[model samples]
Target: MKRIGQAMKRMTVLLLAAALTLDPLAAASRQEKALAETKAQLLSHIAVLASDDFEGREPGTDGESKTLRYIGKQFFDLGLVSGTNDPGHPWFAPVTVLGREPATSRATFSRKGKRVFVLQQDVLVYTSGKRALVENAPLVFVGTGKTIPSRADLAGRVALLLEAGIDGSDRQTALIQAGAAGVLTVLDGDHTLENVAGHRQRLGYALGGEELGGDLDAFIAGKALDAALAGTKLSVKALQDRAAAPDFAPLAVDLAVSLEATTRETKIHTHNFIAKLPGKRPAQGAVLLMAHWDHFGTCAQPPAEHLICNGAIDNASGVAVMIEVARRLAKSPQLDRDVYFVATTAEELGLLGAKAFAENPPIPLSRFVAAFNIDSVAIGPAGQAFSIVGQGLTPLDADIAAVAKQQKKKLLMDNRAEAFVRRQDGWELLQHDVPAVMVTSSWGDVTRVEAFLENDYHRPSDVVSPRLELGAAAEDVDFLTALVRWFADPRRVPYRSAAKPG
Candidate 1:
């Protein structure tokens, strides 16, 4: 018996030594396993979401329904509670969207009561609302549409703007706010009149209750403007040249314009899928993680063999990364502040879903410690550098930089990615003064991104194939997981000084 007791003691000591020796290695193995599992999940999600079965995940369609169910199931399976704060429809926040397409448009211009023959094809007028009209409003050249005259000066006048790669919606909104009766953007950049007209001719979408545009928002061909300016002191070239001056201001043109447009509208009901991982101290504010679950449905018309725009890298990859990040965070220790996961709808339709969330948040907008948006994350290889889309626009840069350093990942500190800032869902949140950013490796290499944009972007060819590089995306998942944890620590990330309105 004494011999046996001594032997047992020796075995126990050996076991304790083994555990101590293997602890670090075991932890590393576990981390590697977790990362591998996340990569597998990321691939699986992209495949499923980008498949034809999803029908491109367009809002107000069966595709949307399937997407919502899939994302909701992921959240539920991850043990995330409803972030919507609604008891009935726990996972969704309803958003009403209006889709509009131009039906009929007409415009006429005159000078000194003499008729001006502006070709009908040269002017494209349309509205996202029911109808719009302008009756003999005087034309005021606003130059590049960067600066506008006062409400007093612009009231009851049609503003002629030079399109210079400016965001049309923002410019139109500014003109509208300045009391301009109408806006005519003259083609002044690389975009041809036909391309602009074709884009405007397609269906345009906006939030249901929101105003669409100025009374008569239209695009005018530069040649057409030149023709209208004939026999006058003002010329298209001269006006464009004058626009380059630093002191350029609104100049009145001796032209009277009348325009009318009617649009066909369709109302679509959609929902934003929101879920939450509750934290210990809810008052510390929450961290938001979001990705849009939408793409162009049936982008190709009949006679095309491939009709669906399988948005594998355009955004399915993004949503997959978001989900994998959520999964990793959920398994970690409880955070000091809650973390919310949002799968926004109708992002393809001018970020309508993101706008809806910002306008009517389940939680106060000010309560968000920080919001991180993932988008188009599957473009680069494993070692590619990452960039923040809204780098200098917010105060979260330092913390993000710290995380990147700790993870030993390459981070581009420039604001080059900001070129695409207005094109993503993050822009809507940023407009509402919420600190939102898209940290992605996809945009780090502009060459690759441009190639994807030129070839597969928005095309049926954007599918789950070998060409879709996801190694860097998997790394992004891990990095973003770290970011969520770091930000969710109330001790680490300070609360906002002044909270913005929801």
Candidate 2:
């Protein structure tokens, strides 16, 4: 018995030695040092992007330009092709826009009716300011602001609109292209309504004048609108009649909005950085991994507008994840098809940058297989599994499930309910019929994510460290990295879901 006890002690000592020397299994294929690097990379990138210097990082601002340039420089150094740089440098894809520039002086904005009200309370216009008058500022009240050229007579009329479903469901772009003059827009309330195009993003005050520290036009929500119209002294119908024509003469029905502040009609140019890692097959399909780099640079107001919306968790974290994930793929073996890592801009302005990328894709849109989007890893505790907000609605669900298995995380599909899978750059891809999913957490429903976002989403409170849990984000990075590997190197592209579309 004493001999056996001595043998057991020796076994324990050997086990202790192994424990002291051998490394533990890591969630990621990358080692501790590499993981540390990734974590540090994420933290560092987020810290800078979410820093106060970038303000909210809105596009067209000095901060956004700086941010894009930084990302571009990093991509260039990472062995990626130069996508259109300043002059002669060739880019994989040049960032471009087809929009009017803002003006330096006040704009003359008015509609054809006294009672119709073309003023701020009833109208919202984003002008290039160089032009004093928006030709034919006629007010055609389309029911909800959805359908145009079919349900309503939209040719040669300025649209006075409410949210979708209020009049008819009309696409805003179609209305503008159909030769509608200055548009009059009404607030869509909040997310609770979910009315036609009732996106809460429209409520953001990060407009041109707002961010530039210039006075933005606003209506006092109550008597101000009434007082403006009381001065019109013209009938709504008579004003509408006067407004009808290719070029109608100006009448008393015209109302102009004047904000007492210096305006600049300067041209705004910004770009999104793209890095390509070619794959083996080169033709079957491609999976996109994306994140937005722009944030709320500056507010239309301070203290009240919360100044800078640093957007640490709002996006810098997501962009950092993209960089880390890209680095991993860069080091891995060839994939079946191409994988593109895109860091977008102007996402805060309605996913404009992403939309532009989609409309003019680097590859065939039909060949675009899937999109995996990361947006601010605000929750999702480590060792605790989570779900894709829009799981099972696409082919990616099975892949995510397989990932959950590899991660040992018990995944849930319908946990976030209404919020699941409806946001981030992935959702934009989903709209174009590409299979896509977004992973994020506004800290579950119980947490202060909503309030936090309300107060800090675009505010300086969005800074890194104090605003985020690096450990929690690390777990997400691991799970996501593994999933991306599986996605690009799958034996077969995952099958689409049998479920109906949302």
Candidate 3:
């Protein structure tokens, strides 16, 4: 009896050891080789959608209608639900934004203790957020501000931050977070004084500030002005020396923030085309995927040399990849939760599509498990597999990494850099507290952003190019498939407890 027991124990130990040892082959299978017919179906769809015949798929036009219907038909044919289905099915989300040209804004800031009026060159507009109005009133001087999630000092006043000082406060973020009347920031960020442009045009969109009025048409310029000093004192040189000091703190002034801005009255409608993949035991949560389908709408060129602004690669490729992923997933296997595939419109117009989608979605916003966005994967082989932007989100990275291993593709995150979490559509999701990630290769890279813009972006030549590579696209589709499968699986949910250091 003792000898028999000993033999069984040794056998059990041996089996466990072998199992651990056998775990090395990052298992990879060309499973698509089996789904060839499906691949053909998808490729044919992409070809037509990307061809010049589609006129670049711009929104609010005939081309947009044709493109939407075609992709919608593809979704229907694939058996996945439309994201707009009132219930757990197909759907369309209508989004809108205020589109208007800004009038020249002429305003003056009188620095406290200074008799000379400051240059308007110090301000810029931070126009990327919920649109609202800036009424005529005296802007209050709120010291270093406070925020919602974190308590910033700027509770209710317009932050009057000194040009180059770090007042132990993040002025811009704080003012916006605290909901100040409006932010009138100068070039106080960590920029070199020597590089400062002498002339400031209103507030450039790049800098984080806003025009006193939201979108009023007015004439303006930043001509030097004289101010009547009341309190202590300061001359232009003194003000310059103070504003230029890195630690300078903005002194409060009895300044009136009198500017006028009102809503456009008629709202601009943006859209988010949504699709769904129903899962088995869909845990109250869902797997979300977002892709922006809007590109620069039309080209402003002479008729003889003009053609539609074809956004074939800027977004047709992304839309194609997402559509294929939805199709492939519909047939392969089922998951525990629903999968939402969204193709947001007007992304080219300041991420209006993504912004609108996040504001109000068809599915219960809170039930979302995580978000995966496939932006631009024009090429790959950069690392082992393609590159993933915004892999910084803990839970998102874990799933992408695991799936990368399964596909025998490197879960390469360290080798690349993409402010992607904050750059494209992914950032919109991140703000809503959803764990989101964007998977892309070179096309997804930062250097590639301007590169694409320089060549095909918003240009007529953006149609499917002979030099374009579609093979890498297939790989992207495959990666997305694997990622969705990993997340939707009941027990294999994709949220990490901690973020791995790069």
Instruction: Give lDDT tens digits, candidate 1, residues 289-318.
Output: 999999988999889989999899979999
Candidate 3 or 1, higher TM-score: 1
lDDT of 2 by residue, 1-502 (tens): 9999999999999998776566455324335566466667778888787777776677777887667766766666666554322234244344443333333322234444223333332322333232334443444555344345433354445555443332222455455566554344443333122232243213322223222322122112223334445645644343344445444432323454433222333333666676776778655566778888887666646446456777888888787777777666667776776777788876776676777677666665666667877777754344444657666667777767777777676676665534635556777787888777764433333254455556666656676665476555666677666776676664656323213222
- The models' CA-based lDDT, in order, is 0.87, 0.57, 0.58
Once superposed on the true structure, which residue ranges of model 2 sit more than 4 Å away at CA? 1-38, 53-56, 76-92, 96-266, 300-307, 378-380, 415-417, 420-423, 440-448, 494-502
Report the candidate with higher lDDT, 1 versus 3.
1
Worst 10 residues of 2 by lDDT: 213-222
Model 3 residue runs over 4 Å out of place are 1-43, 51-53, 87-90, 103-223, 227-235, 244-266, 381-384, 441-450, 494-502
C-alpha lDDT (0 to 100) for residue 47 of candidate 1: 94
Candidate 1 residues lying further than 4 Å off, grouped into runs, are: 1-34, 109-123, 138-154, 159-179, 183-196, 218-256, 408-410, 441-444, 497-502
User: Considering summed lDDT, which 10 consecutive residues are worst modelled in model 3?
Assistant: 217-226
Shift in Å, residue 328, candidate 1: 2.4
Worst 10 residues of 1 by lDDT: 493-502
lDDT of 3 by residue, 1-502 (tens): 8999999999999998787666554212234453344345445655677666676676666777777787788788888876686563346666655544333334444443332354444333323222334533333333223212222333333544334232213555445555555554333345432333222222222111223233221111211211322243543335446655666554544554333332222244445678888887654478888877766555656653746666666677778888888877888867777998888877676666776677767655666767887765553322334667766664667667778778787555663545445667878877877677777554434565666667766677766555565556666777788887777765776323224211
Q: Order of candidates by lDDT, top first?
A: 1, 3, 2
